[model samples]
Target chain A: MSPTPRRISTSTAVLPADGRRQNLSLVLQTLRRLGPTSRAQLAREVGVTKVTMSDLVAELIGEGRVRDVGTAEQAGPGKPATLVDLDRSGLLTLAVDLSVPARLQAAVVDVTGTVLHREERAAAVDAGQGRGLDPAVVVELVRSVLATAQHPVLGIGIGTPGLVAPDGTVRTAPNLGWTDVALRELVAEATGVPVLVTNDSDAATQAELSTSPASQDMVLVQVGRGVGCGVVSGGRLVRGAHHAAGEIGHVTVGTDGGETCSCGRAGCLETWLSVPRLRAALDAGDDPAAADSVAEVGGHRLAVALAPLVAALDLSEVVLAGPAALLEPVVPVVARSLADRLLPSLDTPLTVRLATSPEDIVLRGAAALVLWDRLGVV
Target chain B: MSPTPRRISTSTAVLPADGRRQNLSLVLQTLRRLGPTSRAQLAREVGVTKVTMSDLVAELIGEGRVRDVGTAEQAGPGKPATLVDLDRSGLLTLAVDLSVPARLQAAVVDVTGTVLHREERAAAVDAGQGRGLDPAVVVELVRSVLATAQHPVLGIGIGTPGLVAPDGTVRTAPNLGWTDVALRELVAEATGVPVLVTNDSDAATQAELSTSPASQDMVLVQVGRGVGCGVVSGGRLVRGAHHAAGEIGHVTVGTDGGETCSCGRAGCLETWLSVPRLRAALDAGDDPAAADSVAEVGGHRLAVALAPLVAALDLSEVVLAGPAALLEPVVPVVARSLADRLLPSLDTPLTVRLATSPEDIVLRGAAALVLWDRLGVV
Candidate 1:
């Protein structure tokens, strides 16, 4: 997660202006993604009128945010039209993934979700716990990464794992031993730049806006040392009143209170499904193939746990996140359970598939969060 | 639930112009809730300026939505100011609760949440199944109740006990043995009014909004013949992506997976906490003080099941649907587990409470749904 910017997304002052400015940015973003395209193509692509497209393009050019690069190859037409696009050097963003355990990971992203420069170093958070992670070291890591950058970093978005209040205070993070920590203030103080803090799960959700096969309504269950889920319901992230809507790891899935969890409770879904537990469970299973694996559990229980949710929601798909070794065990179990419990009258079952976002889903999400923030999508 | 007024709610042609009208309605609702108040009081009460209030009131009076009543004694020594209120005679509303077994509950509400007239009929749903329930009979029962109404009917809102779609379809209701049933269409066809469908639990949530000391963020658990929950996250009803976010009944609280549920699942939270099971447990237990015989045994298992969620969401309050026989036996178990599992770092313990609404919460919620639809709150 890059640090949050100095200014909030969408100035309250600018909000009263006609929404055309927002539409203009959207056009720039779309053109950057589709590459240089003619004005007619942009109008159709952005679902805008030719006049609106030309006006928006003019505004973007006036701001030096877009360019008329060249002409497209003429097909059997009158004459080839010139293609326009977002100026490659328009804006730079800092994508920071605070979920990375060992260090602060930072990357510069352009208008298109393309990485400009990326680096990582030991995090200072460990030092704050007196267990070796230091905030200063983490600041140094980001500073060092910034050293190689040339573009003005418009904003920084950091995706931390825990409950993040909208204002950037980390309300609570068990892993980092942080509670009510004004993290963005400290990050900005350290880096001399704007800072933003968001839940790591939400960052992963923002990552989806850039992935292929855009989801209509999405669920992202991130499996790591601990487990969490990020939800996109009704086309927006589910940020509950307390900003803790995606904390699904602590959902109790066992009535017997089977295993103790770090949350100081037994039978917590996270304790059973976490990487450490799955590995432990695999170690307990005694199968040669499953030995020393996190994915060795019988997927049956997991399927039972999630079935009702799927049935109740009438959701068509879910994206699973985790190393293949960890999630492999539960995939088939989820598949079968989904097939059996669907309304018997329905001919097809819901799809439960692994996230195909490049292996760096969290990293990608962190970057996307920066982009969304810069553009004020929310 | 009164019928949903689709014709008015979906008038895109009235956009921008309606935004002004909508603000006036917002002002009217605020006044209804606060009772008669001066324009100055209205401005402060509705979170608007005096100028905005004046503008809104003028439009509202022009539209006959509000009227000025003579002044009462001023608390302080200012000139007695005229008081304003919703003009009940401006528009009439009808509310219906369709899921109350053997009953068709109806009421009239003005722009305010006040009840004007109340009526009900003995009715049942989906009698075709051995459960002796019939969807058709239930529909007709609602029709008959509306037949005696003196005021113009608003849209109808039906609160069922199971999953509902955004478009008002009853997707799968095991208790009612209904599937892919177009409830909105049926109610519309029968009453000649548009309709909205909500789960009983979600309806309870809406009902909470009208009560004193309203919950900002809480969970409402309806422990009837079946166990279900409505989540108020971000202070809004969490309808998930497909309007089924709170299907905690099938959350698998028991690791044993020994108990079976009507959903054909084993070890669902509903199997143990539902009314029948709670009653059975009380009857079987030797404890003399266990007078609240749940139709079955509902106990610590429910608390344990809720443990993970408490830890996960860090939710501090829970509102249990009340009734001496229904809620008394279940509250303690949930409270103990919630308190015991809370991490020491959290200063407060999660609370278990009762709904302020009546035993016919779902039915009342059904009625409110109609009001919200007609008034365009939903």
Candidate 2:
């Protein structure tokens, strides 16, 4: 017997009850992307009635999320319309980044994504035993950032290295020696605010997505002490079925075996591409050929790892986030390798470039988590 | 200066104007999945009012897309309710499959996805010169299939081996010796039915998706004379920016180079995994070990090509569509290699299996394209 076709609905059906939230999110997102605009202009831009636009704007203003920023210059207009914009100084998000090995960084970010305050501390780690950062230390760092906030804090967002569940539990961060640490709960309790935790690479991806004009389908590779990636397809972050969508660090790359990884795998991507390994290779000697060879091998491995992704998703760009010196040399190698692997297409050539804001990417991405969670904006 | 966060709205905002089409599609999809359904039950399941559901159902019935079944078995009810379902016999779709080399296959499929009539003809090919099927032959076959239709045909859907543009242009089907051929226009002009052309691998994916209970995130690999993949992420088909998504046959897999492909690339996935090569290796000798080695090497290459995709997309399953003898042996090798490459996780193990309906997959998938395009039900 022929099997019946079980077609699943992929329609964009929205319930009437969710209309308000959807409209509100749309309005906020519009303002965030296009900057300040007149109420009438917003109604036209968002395709809502003038009355509905007025009500949404009023609600945002009353919530201290928006403010009337004087008036706009007339361009052959009847009157100068008062401009409404997000209140950048009224709300704040405390962001923590635990991606750096043996270090902790935090920042107070405003609504406009401006970092008002920043702090860093050396993390105490049992390096010999590979034990990760202490839970208390992470909580203290969040509190320390919270104490420096000058505005009403919306939430605390932490981007840590590990497999983070949607509920903010760190399933495992081998580099940090963490297993099932309730980082979000600890930070929220210690600081008395809502908290969101995500994989640092995903956070960085969000930050890159929010700050750059990249294509909706792109991957951000985070090369630090450990290697990971954040993937975005169709303008949405790809959190895998197991929340391990970008866990590429441990994927064995090539047939030829190389350095061993902490995961007990030889020829893993991390062994070839991690910042520590690249830096070690560079520091080995003044022999540029040796350093170049390391970069070449790492780049080739990275290309091997990324080729399938590029082919499968038809990715337009690959953004590498790390020290430019280490990654820049690797870019050409990756580009060449990808060209060799994928179909030769004159149009839609894949580009590999460094992240523009590499230094503060994770911190800003952590803030994006709070922004998206609390306000449904970004 | 820090850049402002440009948050694109990913909210499911439906314009009031689009409400009607969305609801109608929802109802049709519901019927297609659950068979016959009562009006009241459909309203409840779709979270819409009975009046709205009735109006949508009436429109579908008037269009001859749906029909009312006599009655449903009463379950703790005061009276039996009339059931509504898709009119399987009233409408038919003409599907064409030009994927098999030197063969042209066509089928007339009804709403229930049953093949009502089928026909096949040998394609005229300049084998020595590598010229593919003549366009006149394809058009003639479509005419023959349309003439046999017992009911009104919805459209013509084609699954061909090529890079198809959204406009139904066969941008390049090297197997068919077609370049920038306006296939949809040519077929529609001759048959007077709207035509949709898509890559055969993508078509097979649609057929598999519509027939099986596979995960939303999955990839279907088609192995015949060539290799290609169809990727589905988050329940939606991934059409790349250039409409070249899932064009993975040419991607080089391993470091060691092997036989050269027609694309002039050595060690392409097609060079290692195509059916002809596997068959040639199996026929090269009576030794089982040699055939096993061919399968092993092909399996390893496939694994290398897929590991990054698995890690990047966090796919839940990989479906192989081809002859059982050739593909079944390659499954375990791919699974074991993926396990070696990816992190070990007990929660979401990726499954690799053979497609259940390999013989009629492309033809059925072509019908699915018509279904999704015309009714927006899939």
Candidate 3:
């Protein structure tokens, strides 16, 4: 069965069609998080106004989406300032992460982005990643989890690997060996709940970004058995023309005519960076010095392959998603390479970070994606 | 002193407090473009109603901003269609390109985006990296052009290469050696006209995407001595958090130590791609056999840089910007690299196209940026 999920606050995602509802939701969510925020501060953060915030807060309280948390710390107060925040237990959401390579995770996500329940198990889809995995078994696994789920689930968010069209089609999923799958329909029809399907890496990136300081403009690189990236610009996920962006694994990095890549090419960066490929290269003992070469010259070749991206985009930070054991050994080489190549023009130093994602993060991300949609993009 | 500048279209950079006028303006502009067409087409394209389009068209014609262009082709012999388009000759806009690296350029743009009079001069801003080119000289140049112009200039648009904050302040310009310069004020003061400022590469990208067959998910890479890129995802520019997106020149390309970069670092792709740097590499007389190195490897490197961007975002194309003499040499390399790196899953091949840009694309880009604003972003 799947694990539990995390609490979600929606601000950067699309809002409800009616702007008044969007504004009202924003006020309630912000107040919930801030534990009793003033109307001015709420307006300032939400890019609205004190008058609007006040009106919205009143409406939300009337709707029970929010409540007065307490009185504010006043500066020689003429009146005891009223503090407001979301009713933490008022609404809870269920998030599902079928995106994991081999495991199913589920979580109970509250409106404040708190994770209430968590689970982990052998995911069915992962068996297909080149090792006789079946799609039907995966569907069954998701079913069992939802059947056992606690709390009144508002929605189900599924973050999986593949090409997800804006209209909710899984055009291609190599991991699952699937194509043009009617993902939303099947899941929505089965679960009898509103479902949202998004690219797995995109969801992880969203999770990382939603909780990070630099959510506005950042690129999140996921280095696992393969490498991919997600970009957040202007407080929104960068969904490309055909959903094919952030596929950095195919970048050619090797200077020599080297090994063949999974994409059927020779000497690609993926040949050097991905876990299985790197492990295999290490095992070959063929490039005898390849082991020592790990930190010496080609730990991942990621820095070199990624320098142009950072330079061209003027992005200040790069976040990573992967196992600590695999990612740790390579971070330094990449970091050193990056430090050497930054543009002289940028005043701020670029940073490379690791995503502190828990097992529940993917599921949380999925649920958060929907929640953000509810609150309206910040 | 200046040529009569053509108008890209009607637009306002400013987001108004009241949105009613914004919606009205959008309707007016749509009618102006599609011609005195039926209410149906405008309704679908503008996301308004047939009645709404009619009302807007009536208001625009009443204000003399629009006129009947001609009659539309009869569809199934329903009604003799009325064709309508903008009264193109009436609207006037000033387009300025302060970000022009080598020679300073300015012009008076009209509603037709025609340059009535043009003036040119030379100025270097960023110690020749083209980063910190002053926006003021462009303002004065606009003034000189406007002094003799006949049309009623409605608004001014200024495009430059740097990080432009939404408020019109250039936070940082590495090439132009500028930081925190308020460009709009200088332009307004010099030209005595309202102005809008934007990133130069972004403006160029906008011009490229606003036209025919443009993909929503595309990368516009402006190749010069210093390479810059613009990302369009879901039809919106991905301006990073600090608004610094599309600065690809600084990304690292060398897996190991190589040469120091212009950014006071080492092994940056910019060192290999920039005009002087590449020319120097080519002129070193290293080997005649490596004559095609730039052509073969440069494009490949670009493709690699784009791999992650494309795969992650599911983007469809990459746009190369530069005079053919410069960009043509790298096409094959890019194609080869991309071919090798593509994931086996994609059915449709990604496209890398040389920008079909105008002679003075930066100027047109500036004007086009204004046009988008005039049309109403939402």
1 against 3, candidate with superior lDDT: 3
**Residue B178 CA displacement from its true place in model 1, Å:** 4.0
| lDDT value, candidate 1, whole model | 0.63
TM-score, chain A, candidate 2: 0.93
Q: What is the lDDT of candidate 2?
A: 0.83
**Please, what are the lDDT tens digits per residue for candidate 2 over residues A119-228?**
88887666458666788887777778788888878888889988888778899887688889988778777777888898999999999988985577899999988788
When summed lDDT is taken over every stretch of 10 residues in candidate 2 chain B, the lowest stretch is: B1-10
Show where candidate 2 strays beyond 4 Å: A1-13, A48-56, A127-131, A189-192, B1-13, B49-59, B77-81, B127-132
DockQ scores of the candidates = 0.19, 0.37, 0.29
Best by DockQ: 2
Candidate order (TM-score): 2, 1, 3
Instruction: Tell me how candidate 3 scores on lDDT.
Output: 0.65
lDDT of 1 by residue, A1-378 (tens): 011111111111112122454566567557656878888878877666788788878887888777888988888757798888777676676777767666567787766567778887754445354563455655666777767778667567778887887678788776665667887777778777667778887787767646743554566777777777776644556665466766766665644556777666775566667666676666676674654333433344455445544543334566677777767657766676545433332434466777776365666676666555655432
What residue pairs clash in candidate 2, if any at all?
A: A132-A176
- DockQ of structure 1: 0.19
**lDDT score, residue A339, model 2?**
89
